[model samples]
Target: MAGFIALLPLLASANAAAAEPGPLPAGWVAAWSAAAQAVPPAQDAPSFNRAPDTAGRTVRQVIYPTLSGASARIRLSNVFGNAPVTLRSLTLGLAGRESEVVPGTLKPLTFGGKTEVTIPAGSAVWSDAVAVPVQAGRPLALSFVAPTNAIATTWHKLASQVSYVSGPGDFSSDTQGAAFRGHITSYVWLDGLAVDAPGASAVVAIGDSITDGMRSTLNANRRWPDRFAALVSSSPAGARTAVVNVGISGNRLLNDSPCYGKALKTRFSADALDQPGVRDVIMLIGVNDINFGWMPPHSGLDCDVPHVRVQAADLIAGYQQMITSAHQRHLRIFGATVTPASLPADREAIRTEVNTWIRTSHAFDGVIDFDAALRDPGTPTRLLPRYDSGDHVHPSDAGYQRMAEAAFEVWSAPRAR
Candidate 1:
């Protein structure tokens, strides 16, 4: 009893152990870029949902990347809007699109003064973040109730993205099952962001092959940034980093490619800064520019175009310009070291030069070495044997894991500032 009393005296009281606020780390950043837009129903296609297609159209996945620096303030987009779009009601609930069905559990979202919004031709609107539980593998339903005379665009001729569709071939309207089968009714959504939330930030991940998880696992969603999301969610500190993957395959930083964000200067403001919940920029690109640049029928193709060789100086300038834009918004810019390529001797030489510049440059807020993280310990120039997805150019599922590990390590780590 005396020993217990002595221990009690030594024990620290909860009040006595009142916590102290240490130096605050940088805010968590989000990365979400609007890709497709939906419009009110038109006479030709009044009610649009993904329909069955023989050309193998299906709803692969629906991704909603969150942002940081603002809580409760969320924005949604179909940035690649081809025409007028309309959305009636929004919901965020268990997709139950294919595997399961949980009825009557749809959540509604809102904005300024109306639930129904009409986006003009070639434009988008941000959704006011409706509080909802958004997690991976959970698809969302953006319902449009009685959307009349609406014209919108989904993924069309988009061989790079794996989204569910209603039509055939195009990610547009034809999909695996009847469009009504996955019918989200245009009035409900599963989960939407809370952009108005205080203390939220977002990081836009811009790039080509690497950002898309080209060689990563199928149906596993093991992309590097996805893994980073898990890490951040589980971490006491990483709770702030909202990593968005804006990488489009075959995309170029300076030119419009089949699978890329536009060039460094043009896309900087759109893909990164324009995001609703954004505060930081983490870039992983340039490899495609090196390899695909040498190939024919490129994303930004032009017959008999100049056989110009894009040099390191050009890339450096692009990086400088992108960083400057982010800086203007008080956002931190982190340049990623370019990864290695399995291209011909000449192309490899160009890649080496670009990577060297990324590592050496002191211009970026920080450097994420995906090249160092995914390369073979032995060869140094190729993706690790196990990480290779058959093509020497892309990473295997494991390779994406390695990429995720590398990025998450930094994303989850305490901020340098």
Candidate 2:
């Protein structure tokens, strides 16, 4: 009895320390993330134009394949906004079907102990850590209300998942889906979600539409990165690694596209290197550059701004720059061979040169032969008939699965160095 009484003080102190937020445990790492891009209302789908302004309204965005964790934080971006954007409230919870959130799971999110936060233009902010239990491959809903008017917003154009917006007022805390009437395919404001997963790191997949899963089933989480995430989560090293998709549709390595974000070299720092706990990057870009290089001037497929025509050598130089940048950051970079795309013979020649360089040059720490994985053996320049999503550009679901498998095999293999 006397010993028990003496130990009470020590036990209470330990409990208090555990409850207080401090430096994250060494084991904690980023579980999931998405790159953000500025989208004009006019460029958005017709459904997205319904609610151009977020003033006094709540937007609920559902994210699939949230890696499991004991606690998590959300990242909000104003990277493309011309003016600061103020968020009045933020909430997170396990998602129910569609826009609804599971009851008894809703939790408030704050930034530096405050519910309201203003993210400056061309900047981003991470919310303070909160206790929110999450599971691997599950869906999580992040809801936020903007009291101040917001016009052009930073969003992920190819969410491949459906999200919702409330009519008016602050409905961020509501667990029911009734208040959400407007629907949008893009994820607004929300950029990335990081969870405190012990003994875990992350890999970022940076690329164009192929990596973006343009042809995959909507809301199905069938993107190659998503598939890779599932594979890593269930592997022997599952507890130590996570995968984040940073692919941007229509993105290029040498030229900027109005619909997509900046070129790979311009945004590599933010999209790949800056991601929380990112240790490796898998880059599979350049198809767009090859295709556009072959297009006639003012063919609508070319970049809006005229620039030096791109060639295989120019793209190889771009890859070299990316490799150097990643090396400077002490990150292991893997080069993924550009996939098969619908292009003329001239452009196909360029792609062949790029792929050969990627595979033999040894410029990258490793190589992922996505081209070999998806290309048809009979016609090496075209995607396999079963793998082609009918466009001859993007791969079908089965093709994505194969690509994921190839990536997983490389990731699992013992590194040469």
Candidate 3:
């Protein structure tokens, strides 16, 4: 009787402890990410016309996470905005058709325990972690209401996924989504979504339009990184790996464009190395650096301004710099051969020489032969007929899949930590 009475206090204490909320899971892995770019002027491209002010409107963006977790957080960027932007509210929910969300699954998100957060210009903010069940490959809709004075100047220019915007008020919490009357293909403000996925790490695929899935079917999630994530999920050795795409359309290896974001040499660290729980990098750039120099200057918004010609040696030096940076962070970086872009003889020679060096240099931790995967057997400088997306440069869905397969065959997930 005395022993039983003594154990009661200890048992009650344990039960009390169990009732209290525990800390969020430890490992934070980037489940979805898009490279942010300054909103180009209307003169740069017609798509910029769709870039909304977002003031007093609800912007709901859909993201397909590559990793699953019990809790998650989101990253909002004003990195290129000229002024600070205040958000009124934020919510996350499972996506339904068009702008609607799954009933009863919507959850509010707070920053530092507050409902509102002001992001200074040229910066980003992360929302506090919320207990939301996330599944790999499932789409999550993130909705945020902007203040009346907010002006959106930072966005992922080529989101390749359609997002929604509401009419004149805060519809961030609207599950029916009837108020979401506006549709945009760009992801404004929102850049990244990370989940507390323990034992999982991310691989960031960084490059230009090809890696950006420029011509892939909209809202279909058929990018090479998307396909790579699918492959990782099925492989027993990499079941816990996540793939993130940080490609920007028209991006270059050495030069920044007025329309495209910063050069990969400049943005590589911030976009890929600094990502949460990233362990590997796969880079496939240089095509633009070789081709942009030949584009004729136009009357307005000449994005390919410098037209600085680069040789195989110049491109090789850029790769060496990236390799050094990746090694400094103890990351395994893989070099991806620049895929066929149907270049002329001069540019084709540069591509061929650069690819040969990439395959032979042994400078990167490994190599991914994207060229071999999509190139025509007959005309080596052009894409295979079945793999071309009709735009000799970008790959079709099958080509993206083949690229993913090539990576998978050489991929080795980070060693257990």
Candidate 4:
């Protein structure tokens, strides 16, 4: 039993490799994704010390999602890191709880057959595929030890899931969670996970906080994308389609946020077009561009953006650029009308204009009317009382479900010939 358990991953890898018969096939579909961004140490950073000098720690991140195949690989990014960082070791396994890996399910991960890997600044590397059968909608854990001090780390601040970090030591193979000394809400080092899904393709949801599931229950997989994933997994498309979320909490369509990284136009290629097996994109952005444009120049969020005022025209042009880029990659793009939000008159006008274009424009391959889905029937500019998450900007779990249903309708529609 012990020997068979240890050989499970190896055998799965051999079977997958034999089926593909060459370099890893292009059929790798993203099962999970968190767009990498630089989180300011002093603002919204996780409780743990995220500075580069914090090293010699073993971290275990639990990922809750299902993969499509028996063989899988992980992608680690240093896109926001200022210097190279060495990962001393890495491993993956089925999770038993918050930080514990199920005994005997843990498997070592390697890059080019080597245990140690140095990820250069502003880039990412995918580990060699391992035979780890992951069930759809299940949880998996990844453990790694950082041997050297890091000066700057690339991470996604709003993981919406709890991850664990341990005291100085290489605990990558530990099956128990007792050694995890602290907890972090954000995901570090990890960015994406892909699996050999044969005919499976993916739809990448590109947007801002609402798409990121800001007010939804944490670690519950209540994001609209998660809801969409559930819908896809049970539909006729279930066996062939997956939904991947690439949203950043404060992301904007026209301008860049310091914490969220580049503007949608600049990061679209990396976050959406470049993902494995991506056949479509559901873009729901622009509220930030409208809301932020109305804020005073001295507002802290204004410092990261240029002083120019953004208008609906500028935002539409940005969407046009994104559409062109997606088309260049032969990926279908679906524009999502921005959801309702209470804003000042000027910003509200811009939102109205942008949403109108998204509905009337023929530029997008298709349009998902998210605005119509969550808006209050009596007061069109505000979210439904039940759907509002209290901020009036984000949505409640009920609202996210509605948004998911709206998107599913468009996604499940018959493709035009």
Name the Cα RMSD for model 3: 8.7
**Residue-level lDDT tens digits of model 4 in 1-417:** 999999999977764443221224687888888888875654544444354333788888888654468878888888877777788679998888778999988999988676767776777888889888887788899988975556446788787888888888899999998889788788887888889888888889999988888889988999999998899889876666778889988788877776666788888988898888889999999887777655566543333455457899999999999999999989899999988898778778888998899889889999999999999999989999889999998999999999999999988888721
Error of 3 at 53 (Å): 4.3
Per TM-score, the best of the predicted structures is: 3
Candidate 1: tens digits of C-alpha lDDT, residues 57-132: 2222344444332233234444455554455544334345452223654455454445655554444455554555
Rank order (by TM-score, best first):
3, 4, 2, 1
Ranking by lDDT: 3, 4, 2, 1
Of the two candidates 1 and 2, the one with more favorable TM-score, higher being better, is: 2
List the candidate 1 regions with Cα displacement exceeding 4 Å: 1-61, 64-82, 88-90, 97-101, 108-115, 128-139, 145-196, 258-261, 297-308, 412-417
RMSD to the true structure for each prediction, in A, is 15.1, 7.9, 8.7, 7.0
Report the lDDT tens digits of candidate 2 across residue range 299-357: 33333343446889999999999999999999999999998885778888899999999
**Judged by lDDT, which candidate is best?**
3
lDDT scores in order: 0.53, 0.81, 0.87, 0.82
lDDT of 4 at 132: 85
Better of 2 and 3 by TM-score: 3
